[model samples]
Target: MKLTPFLAAAAAILIASCGGSNDALDGPSGPAMGGGAGAAGSAGGGTGGAGGTSEPQDAGDSGEDGSNPDAPPGKTAEEACKTYVGAYCSQLGKCSPIYLQLIWKDAAACEASLVPVCVKSLGLPDTAKTPEFTASCGEAIGALDCSSFMGRKVPASCNPPTGPRADGAACGEDGQCANGYCATPLDQACGTCASRAAEDQDCDRDDDCAFGLICSKDNKCTPYVAKGGGCDENHPCEPGLSCKGAVGPTKGSCTDPAGPGQACDTQQIALPGCDLNAGYFCHLVTHVCQKMDLSQAGEACGVVNNGYSACTQSSMCKTNGGMSGTCLAPANSGDACDLVDGPYCVPPLRCVGNVCTELDPAGCK
Candidate 1:
């Protein structure tokens, strides 16, 4: 039977599952199977049927040979299969049952030739719970037999288990928690039930604490207690009020003291005083004040002051410096000398051998 159609159908299924993004199989034709039929036929020339090939061997054909140089040393057959399958799947984009069967056949042929690592790598576990391998050689050659492979059966954990826990708790061994257990130092028990505590829990660091709390140095959960009265580091008070130590020595409270000419109205408690110099209002919440006019501040102050333009506001000049002035260009002197803040300077002030000289208005002095 032609296998090309089957291969195409399988490939199409995989491509569809992948959102039909692959353009490699866009051609009008499918893979030709008869091309390799002759090679297999020659290998089985002595057989009766046309296009016949020697019968593929079963797992029992090759017994374990620990000391055999032709077999992979210190490696299990399933492990080898995982490595080979991973490599093959990387090239094929996806692993299919047929690909596994082909790999098994190829591994068997290599084993018969006494190729080292081939047989041991392809051998399946005898205690496989499922009939992973099919009886038909053709069917077996093109199928993934994962029933006996440990990597396929218990894929969550390999020989040495390590990964995230399914229950959202730390794990260390198979017995720690139930599903998807991972080995970790914190969770010594392999499958111990984890607790959802708000405080005094086993935590590696502060980041493990709840949303508003932090892990303390003693491994306890502590709320972000702000200092001075209001919002602590965790429960920050709104803008205009700062977290300060309250009446008690250890407690904190959010409060805003009334400024000069300002009333102690609770509603306007967070309102900031107007900076006559800077022309900006300070945000009590973040303790940061903003300028109202940045261009004037830039011109009066400097271009690179605090990443803000000095001319942002006219008041910035009065606050930043005692000088209340606008930007001005210096007057020019004809001696190639630097200009200074002045109305005008004498002309024809040429540099004579490094000495500046001002020409007499009448002619030369």
Candidate 2:
């Protein structure tokens, strides 16, 4: 079935690098290159989804690991889910502390927040969890460096346990498929197992490829374009680089994004826009990319020279058909959003009938 990568949103968020220094990217209240105060967060504060934190927080390495003395013993698959979650969150927390701070309170809270996601996406059914796979999975996750962690790379050991279902068998999850791929058709809930595609192989979607490869518009599994390489809507550039001059048959070269005061337009992806990872957004009003004051939650936004973003990563701009909007936090499931600050609920949760609601979890489904 035609499918998108489960980490598609995460991939977009990767443009917001965790660490970098920009002269126009100082803290809020500081002087910017062209006009207004430098924003508190980096250029990608409003990029939304995960990794919205634009500036580098440097919260230090998350000390916990599967090997930590105080860590829980993952003797069962259920417990191993926790171990895997901890290993992932630990590295993520240290990569961008401020973003996590905006959501959960601490490392433990962060782990708690993301555990269900990891478990639901890559884990076995509650009745199917086994310990033999748990230990190896947790250890593999704990060994991931920041690059792999940020890329959402799945360790070989972390793959779902092999099952009796053969390729082409009806399956609801990866664990049920012998080939480890459940080829769900677009807009369908169920799928069948299929063999994975390799680089240069024909493919219809991202999930058909093996690790580190993505399906291109040409319907082939290919590696991501490197920095300074030509790319377009069909040819995606590597994370941290933006495409410039990509239009029609002529491809654009991936280049470092523009900094604050640089000319930009969100409508034009081919242009060398602002540094998205730094929390710089293109201001439609001024037609220039500018840093937003991330600390300006509850403050008015969308005004003249206010940049595309006025709030922190966790929050969004809520404009109710007015000339201006306010920055506010997201609501939880079943929470009333009528009086909330942002326009909508958090990622993975949407405003359904004015209440935040959960959607299908990523992967397999």
Candidate 3:
């Protein structure tokens, strides 16, 4: 955003009043902290307050504090302008042409806050004649304004004119349409025909169907596949059945085929397809095929006794000896000193002797 001249003047006055004693504020005998020049030595002894400087602790130390060093001095108009403008600009994440509008509108406000730093850094007799500050501010504003419309698409005026338009021909703004039927004023190319399958079922690949169902095969709209039903290569089964291992080579099988009391005793019988309604191959006492609840059966067979949920990422799952499960994090993440990189608990219970303790605090309880 740009700072107004009035705001800049006010800012310069405010900053000058606040930092009128920069010369009195001592610094170490070295370059200024923010790459400026100042006398060496400490402002005061011992620990200084925030934004304050103390005695030189080291040789390479520059006493420039984190506060803005580029501020202008005195209660001049230019100093005020720079102060407000710089502060507002710092808040903007990125610089662009639109920012110039802001700069122009808010120049005065920024100057009120920034002039003091400018005066200290520039050593201007008066704020108005500070060429360095003027050049910097102008360049910053100009750069943003020039680059404002870089990625925007060219307007329709740049396009070649077409012959007399038809009744319902493709049109964008009111200027392009013949009878105004398609003169819709949208942000981008407007007035376009709507797609046909706006209400059709969602589908990815094929094969998510029964014997009778056939996918429209159209990229846009495909037939819906019920949960646990046979689907084509493109369509996917419900939540549990991912596309990768559905049936064939890269196919998936249900670990639990039979219902509760059925037997799963057959080497040939693989796990059921992702489609639970189609049926499942239960793991009875003998490894044979027995129809069962594919969803529940898969969950029951997959779960570890320790109550850890199955997750795709190895980091999410933790395995120790024969017992494996998901890792748990302490309630207060910051307070817990035993946290690992991903917040998992460290193994073992407690430490021995006078050495530091290294054990799972949760497991001990």
Candidate 4:
């Protein structure tokens, strides 16, 4: 029987998609917080709004008693841009190229809303409110061009401290490279930055391949096997690609998998995968693509062979001592739980020592 459904979550996300999608830019690196230079900090934005960036010109020109002579000048848009953009840039060092794309989509709008708040808070320290700081920091933000981050492949100059490390330059992890990967390649040094390999190029790691391509068993970068092409454990098909037969490379070839609400058409349902991206699964008994169950919190779940059907994707089915279980949403930090492994805790919080707890702030990087 194919018992592969319970493989580690990291493997499911990392290795299965043919070479796998490049996560070069997914989201910003750290907490999306903006701080003021001095006395006037602004509230942070959520999904849509970035916050206010500027203030009225005459707002800061006086002390409390209707007109004291010791007030700072009103803040400028440029100053606001400096404070806001500087805080933003500080976080980009932690973002992957993929994350940069998300920020690019939202940063400008965030800036638009945030600039007014920054301007209003001009009583902030001279570090951000000064003309020199405004000029330089504003220029840096323009150079980043967060609006244009999409469609532009990350280049060598995108790294911190003078730019992304070049090939052969020292590095610790894949995210440090301008090309979005660092390759040590089989017992080699750990810090060398490696560029993505073009099609047909030789490489030892998947990240060495060009975005969207994969390094095959033959150690050459190749286009993702189209539907119906060969596949295996090492050379999985692209996202949405499915294979028939057993799980190994020699045992199967990529084929159209069953869709949600479609016929499974096979007795060995587990051997033929489903469109996991679409949240479909092969039902072993009924032999069809079953729409995943959407059990709510505390609802009964887990019947026979379908473990995942016990809950919605965002929730987990908490089994008791036996086969029966209840769907529960992920717990937040400090919440009590019945299971050790858990449906798991919600983000920023991790299931630690069987309890949900906040992760270190640096973990965001």
Candidate 5:
């Protein structure tokens, strides 16, 4: 079965809801420089970061160990992704966060799972057997981001050629509604344009409720509770609201999750309380919920008691430097990386790169 972009995007959302950061990304390290002739079947112009393979050069293209020892160590993951993924989708007549989210999953496995599917769907040679393909895949895959993809609109290319239906008109999908979403009234197969329902109005989906209101457990629109107001998983507050307390029948009150300089739970080791959606995370030293600063390649990271705050989420600060160190990309085979807590190498490739490589590996085993 051909997987649609919508399916890929939905999978990303599912993975995120299961309690994972959808915002995993390799910090931008700028595009690679250097050039040879363009290759055949290239997705975008054979630019520095826009990786693509040339015509079959040898048996390597037949699907064996997909490693391009010859391919220039072009741009890092972040650089290549910023160039191609967006361009590839736009060229295919679809460009939006929906597709972007699908391209960049919350973790390496999530992102890797989609690579083969994307290669096959796009008709590219199996990258595993082709060095050129591998080069393109690495960069394009590395630069995926969760924050950038949220709340993005479906591009006009993906929408029905005919404009959306008017309110009260029968609809089956979000694209069919004039407002870009369908609201099920009475649980019918054919929904209608989700007019924002006022307080106490019937509602089946959150979008059906008017601004400042949310759908309660009883499926009725209710005003969103402010700070200290009662709240739970089902009954959520406005954008910045965070329901505290333990998960169960009762959560807690809706309050400001965190502010720019306030303390927060970044690693989520504390209370699982901070709203990650708001970009709130406890900084290593301060443990405050503030936007993290991105550390570029070779920058100091992993300061003492800083909780790896100095490094970007994707890169790791070398372990040798106790208090401060350089932020470098995850090591490959026989390369150096942190073995202490959670090693950052892509799965199957163990933390100690020299120790293990996927021998007879299949799937994410």
Candidate 6:
């Protein structure tokens, strides 16, 4: 029932392992689009997450007001970080008051804590700041209706601003690339910028391709396999399709997530059957699809008989050596953490005992 497109579409395999397997995540404060440790502006990244820093930030300080005459033309990445969250929450409040209620104490609380959460996720350094596309990004998010916001069909304005990195420069995030493309190999975190390969060209991941194609078994960027097509770790499926295998069907095939009230195996990891990102889970008693109960960080939480914790995505009910537990907020990478909560560690990093540790690159299967 661990679902939330907030982390790598909730189902896509990623380097952050939960329960000792590759389950890509959008950290409690993970970016909106891409799941693995991508910055807010990276593909499949930017937007949404759990409670942020302890201090409640002033919403007006996000550079939204044209009060600073001495300020630069565009907002800095650090400033834009707050602006993005503020706009997103403000817009979502129009459609999903329930979600906002569960995540924060109130709309004002969301702006304060969540804004800092977004800035931390982007790993902003107060010293090394740069201009970013702010007005358009905030406007695009603020303009979204419930449907578009839920689907997270973010506009291109939210992408990371072009940085100083050159084409051959080594980078870990798209924001570091001047061309806005960081072609990382599947086996590693850092990659060279602007290494786009044509179809049929040798590649290790879809990022290596120039266009809409997947890297096949032979390491060629080719058309993605269609839904219901044969698939495995070696063969890639088309976008939005999950390659799954279950007890009844041992064969792997590209399949769509089960819709509302559809049958599914709640126990199967590769084929949970239900579309978790869409806010559905396989019910234990009815054995049918159902919506999940939301429990934001800082709220009370507990493990029911079935082993499910009500904490929101990227967070966990931390016992902290007590009988009762409270959901803890997601922390930054390299920060202190407890092993109980996924949110305790930032995206791409998992809590290992008392510290957040990076997982193996191969874990992002």
Q: Which of the two candidates, 1 or 6, achieves a greater TM-score against the reference? A: 6
Model 5 ranges off by over 4 Å: 1-84, 87-120, 124-241, 247-250, 253-256, 262-280, 283-288, 296-300, 303-310, 317-328, 332-365
| lDDT tens digits by residue: candidate 1, 1-365 | 11111111122111111111111111111110100101111110010111001000012221121111233344444444444333323322222222212212233331221122122212312211111110121122224332112011111112111112345543322222223122211101112223222555644332233222333334564443322444333342322233344233343565543333332221222332222121232332333434322332124432233322222100112222432333222112332321111111111122222222332111100
Q: What is the C-alpha local distance difference test score of each model?
A: 0.23, 0.43, 0.22, 0.34, 0.31, 0.41
TM-score per prediction, in order, is 0.19, 0.57, 0.19, 0.41, 0.31, 0.47
Give one digit per residue, the lDDT tens place, for model 5 in 94-203.
21221222122233433343233222212211111122333343332233332112211111122111214566765433333344334432112234544456677886
Q: What is the C-alpha RMSD, rounded to one decimal, of candidate 2?
A: 11.0
Q: Report the C-alpha lDDT of model 3 over 41-92, residue by residue, as the tens digit.
A: 0110100010111000011211121122343335354544454345334322
> Better model by TM-score, 1 or 2?
2
List model 4 lDDT by residue over 205-265, tens digit each. 4445554444455677654444567655445444344546543325566666666666654
Q: lDDT for model 1, on a 0 to 1 scale?
A: 0.23
Off by over 4 Å in 4: 1-224, 247-249, 265-271, 304-310, 320-324, 335-340, 352-355, 360-365
Candidate 5 has a TM-score of 0.31
Model 3 TM-score is 0.19
Any idea what lDDT model 2 has?
A: 0.43
Comparing 3 with 4 on TM-score, the higher-scoring candidate is 4
| TM-score of model 1 vs. true structure | 0.19
Model 5: colliding residue pairs: 66-128, 263-288, 264-288, 264-289, 266-282, 284-306
Candidate 3, superposed: residue stretches over 4 Å from native: 1-224, 227-229, 232-234, 239-246, 249-258, 263-316, 320-323, 330-365
lDDT at residue 338 of model 3 (Cα atoms): 18
How would you encode candidate 6's per-residue C-alpha lDDT over 1-365 as one tens digit per residue? 11232232211101100111111223232221112221111111111211110000011222322123333365655567566656755754554443344344445765664444344334422112233444345555676554334432334444334546678876544445565445543223445656446667876543344333434546775544557776553453443344566233354676775566766555433443454433355555665555555566676654344323355434555666643467666565566764323345444354544455553322221
lDDT of 1 at 132: 19
Candidate 6: Cα lDDT at 176: 52
Query: What is candidate 4's local distance difference test score?
Result: 0.34
